[model samples]
Target: MTGLRVLITNITLAGRTGTEIVVRDLALGLARAGDRPMVYAPRSGPIADALRRAGIPVVNDIAAVPATPDVIHGHHVIQTAVALARYPQVPAVFVCHDREAWHDTPPRLPGVRAWATVSDSFRTRVAADTGLAPEAVQLVLNGVDTDRFQPGPALPPRPRRALAFAKNQGHLDGIRTACARRDISLDVVGAAVGRIVDAPEALLPAYDLVFASALTAIESLACLRAVVVCDGRGLAGMADLPTYEALRHGNFGVGTFTGPVTAGAVGAAIDRYDPVMAVAVGQRLRAEAGLTAWTDRWRAVYAGILASPAGPEDSEARNLALAVHLQTWDPAVAPSSWTAERASLIRTLARLGSGLEPLDPGVSVAATDGDRLALTGFHTPEAWGVWSAQPTCSLRFRPATAFGPGRIRLRLAPFLPAGSPDARLTVTLNGQPLGELSFPGADGAEPRDVWFAVDALDGVTDAWLGFHSTPCRSPVSLGLSADGRRLGFSLIEVAIEPD
Candidate 1:
């Protein structure tokens, strides 16, 4: 498969949890496969920075660059739903992490060129809702990162504490009662229970029986405990004999993954929930599945997209395919529920690449009109390679967005870079460097919710969030999380903030 200029859009990488984990894993997988993965986030926080660190290209805006994508992959419903407003071409795939997320889709949606679901069951349900053929929807499958979630010692030694944090919190009641009968403890964590059964995930080890009923279960397993998972049945046979079989073969038993769930099926699962044996079983399954193999599959997916024809809603004439909302540029246009919206905006901007550049071509700014930066180049993997050599390019932006509390955002090029970088920020209130502030990158794209505290803006009309070059090459790399990388060397914003 040839290289593809793919566009990856999503809600936010603001937190260190569920959807974010999947995003990181996917980005990492794409990156490792020799494809350029540009991450366009609407909002960002610590999570966004983490993604940059892992060598993924990140940007804030979409209109900055002129490069068109060979394919577009939306990580979530929001991503696909929103992209319809921007792109004329149909997407290669809309990755639905949760079927329930479709309920939030905008009406009369333009169907993706392809559909992806994390679970086969969810895929069937989505097909019914979309009125599309069941076979049309593909099961991309949400895989567990075995490296992050290896099985630990077997039962007796492994605790029986269970969790159903995000997607699986609904199964706590039945699982708890079953644990009681089995003489094992069950501890549930996450925001679903609210004030009633609130428990920090940090205290998960207090219980012996670990029952994972949702995405949170993966985190529990990551803790290296004996766990049973309910996939289909009420118990989904999460603690069935297979878990025991697995434990007997492995060193320390972890637990088992259930087939699915059934009604009123707690007592039986608890009786059979074997942590030690389950761990072994999960390991074997993972080995058979082979994460490296999974990564290879993702590589194929990327390569296939790169070599495919222009997607729907896309014109075959030009090399440039990816486009975005250039007029309405603000965090307000994003999902208000997330904090990484702004980061996403800026990160996408930095990733804007030249259109249809050769496999080994390069890119440099040909012209700039006010806030609109005109890029002159083709959209190809070679452009990506050249950009990756330097990852980022920052300009002292004109304070067109008002020197207020908002970010000076723009459109970025492609999204294929290695990692985010630590930056050295120096705020200037009237051309004076107010000491120095250093911002750090993270493991993957953990949106940086950086609050750039500029020194007294009292009576000051303009301010400059000083940005000096560092390692991160993201177009949205406001040298400082609280600053900007554009503008004339002259009139600087007298912006003094504790970056």
Candidate 2:
């Protein structure tokens, strides 16, 4: 696999998710293994920040990738489709990291050379669903950076501190009960805790036992912590050799055919937890699921994909692939009903007015040249709309389409000015006041959706959707000197929905 130019695409590079970690590790590992791995993502967050800090190249545009990469590997279906469409001559592979990646079947694209799943259970199911030969979809377990998540010190015999580093809300009560029964102090973390902790690798070593599953479980095992695989679904007890082997094939038995997480099962796992046992499990995982081992498997897969013949081109297959991408966002884009007539007049429109052509005829976008901000490095297809301070350059959109009872949803990039009061956006429908939306003063790229009901739009064939914000200082004036634009809001997406 020497000199292989591998282009890896993921939907987002936000940290706190296992997918981000896998992609980050894969890039770094591949680089270390003497291969060129470039990452393409729509958005940047913790993982992207880390990658940049480590000198790993991350690109936002697929066009920016070399004209002839040796392989295209993607984590999400839409990304795979984009790659296949843009690089029709390249060999591609889609990694099924979650149930949804292949739930509707792999993108029916001609360029996709193979599929890889994080677990064997998914490998088999996806192969069956996509009708690919069993060997075409292989199992590539998620790996932890053993060097970073290496074992802490030996745990005390009577460990009282426990942590639940998972996001499964369904298993929280059981985890609490089990920890209480075992007289251990439990600190719940992850998305279930209302926030995603940014430093999972640093946090795991502080606990004696952890309730997690999937990559978290593997990472905890590497940190020499006794892991109870209760990922919101059910309990798959600590990784004693038997349980480790059984759980390994099923994502630690979290969402894969495991019974519900029960207090008894969790409590029993807690009672059975031993420092010596935890050490043994961690040692085993460090060798088997380490970063080196995982990347080696991917390296071989890339080599195999490149060595194979290109998939035969089929026009129907390309359309099917596009349908898979569209269906992920809306089932209304079903292959049977995607006749262009019933399709949402507006689908995946990036902004009110941008250089890109309109996705629907019913929508009209017009803006002053200065108001259009090119958010070219992100997931959006069009440059985003920056609220212009100038009166005639504000963000406004008019949809010339009849509608039933429904509402319009605007997805804005979460942006809050530093040291400023909360900003309120007054939305209007057809020259009448709909309501106001507020955004807290914070800074992040997470999407915030604001919906305004348009009950008055029932019989109307056209209406104006307007966003007005209180006049504010420009980013540069406010001391964010790098950004000179006096923008009110960055509009990422807007769509109408039936009430």
Candidate 3:
């Protein structure tokens, strides 16, 4: 993987935004991994100097036209993220650091093919706006350099690290209250950090108890302090460094960083953790989640893009012409409407050129006998939990309408109690699951694709789909139309088939 080149775009090196941290960590990690990781950002300040000082080369120019060095990436560079689309022939990936970025404007340029986001929550948001599947959006959590961090100095705080944060967050306030009812000084090292607001800069580093909002936590670790975090939040791979290290060494004057923040939880952390012996934990994480390790992750992405199909805008236009020559094409997925009829699909496919393949034959279907295809039937109580409404079938029926076998020349209708991947149904035939042509979903409040399939089933009498139901989730409704106003099956030239 050595010598693989990657150009990170749209970052200003000097500021302390998460974008900077990501670039710094990425460069540092890449260096450790023996990579040629180049960062492109506005040339200025300590950030640029710092990157250079750290041996990371900086390419400063906002409008710099990027050539194929291997891969071209724009991160934290909104609006321009989709600029990758301009290089339609090039396999480019856009990185989004902000969650609500797409709300105001499209995050992608019709040119870009792939996207990456920092959090799953944020990834989902982007996928919805881009009309891309969630998988099209990759989840690469921010990482940390465990090597540059260690358990914080034992500057005799009025209390210990774990105890301090527990107390500072007022975990003891409950004890203080219960004391009126008979309890005192209880420690809950792990507590929930719901919505976060920035704390005073000067006060953050020296705060008595340190419950991290991920960003600050990893930074605190670099400064040698133990960090307490919510169960799920933290640096992607290396987040567990603090707790694991403290427990491993038995010497940091600390213990595990965990939650369910309770007296028992705190006591357990303290009981088996050895801060001194914990050094191994940090060392191991450095090997596993460190910069070098993550650089490898980026390398694969670069390689995949380099090997992918793409063209310039002019070339894309030519491709459309070629596709039209073939009379088959797919335009950028447009909302289903009379304006976007079967004729529109044919034109869109022309834009796609002959290089792109149709979704899948198995998932494509049209209603032949009627508007509804009783693909399969099932029921759930009004209340259900995280259950997959996704059903698979092995049956096939003649198309009331069709483009080609399994080709959705026209969208009969599409509905989801939820939507998209969450749309609940993905087509599988004769036990084979279709890729890019699949569906899996569950019930939720908002509109989503909870049932769908990339292709239509060809043959079989019986079929089964994976399903789940729980108390916390909802009244399950299946989608049946393109506008998604009705609950029924997509009337394609088929019926539910089984594997």
What TM-score, to 2 decimals, does candidate 2 have? 0.63
lDDT of 2 by residue, 1-499 (tens): 4878888888788655777888888999998888888888877787888887887778778777654678898777667677777777788888887653332246666687788887654554466456765466788877889888868777989768988865757678778897887788989888867868777778889888888888888888889988877765345566787667767866674333233355765776788878888898789888888888888998888888888876566778777766665665465544422333233225324432332332222221222221222221111122444332221112333334445467777776435556565666666553457797666666553667777777744443224344456424433221121323234456656666765
Greater lDDT among 1 and 2 belongs to: 2
Candidate 2, pairs of clashing residues: 234-260, 234-261
lDDT of each candidate versus the true structure: 0.43, 0.65, 0.41
How far out, in Å, is residue 43 in model 1?
A: 1.9
The window of 10 residues in a row where model 2 has the poorest summed lDDT is 371-380
Best by lDDT: 2
Model 2, residue 494: C-alpha shift (Å)? 42
- Candidate 1 lDDT, tens digit per residue, 44-104? 6665677688867666566532366656677655565455555655345666654333322
Candidate 2's displacement at residue 429, Å, is 54
Choose 1 or 2, whichever is better by TM-score: 2
The segments of candidate 3 whose C-alpha lies over 4 angstroms from its true place after superposition are 32-34, 63-68, 79-90, 102-106, 151-209, 219-225, 230-287, 311-499
- The number of clashing residue pairs in model 3 is 92
lDDT accuracy of residue 119 in candidate 3? 50
Give the Cα error of residue 176 in candidate 1, in Å.
Answer: 4.5
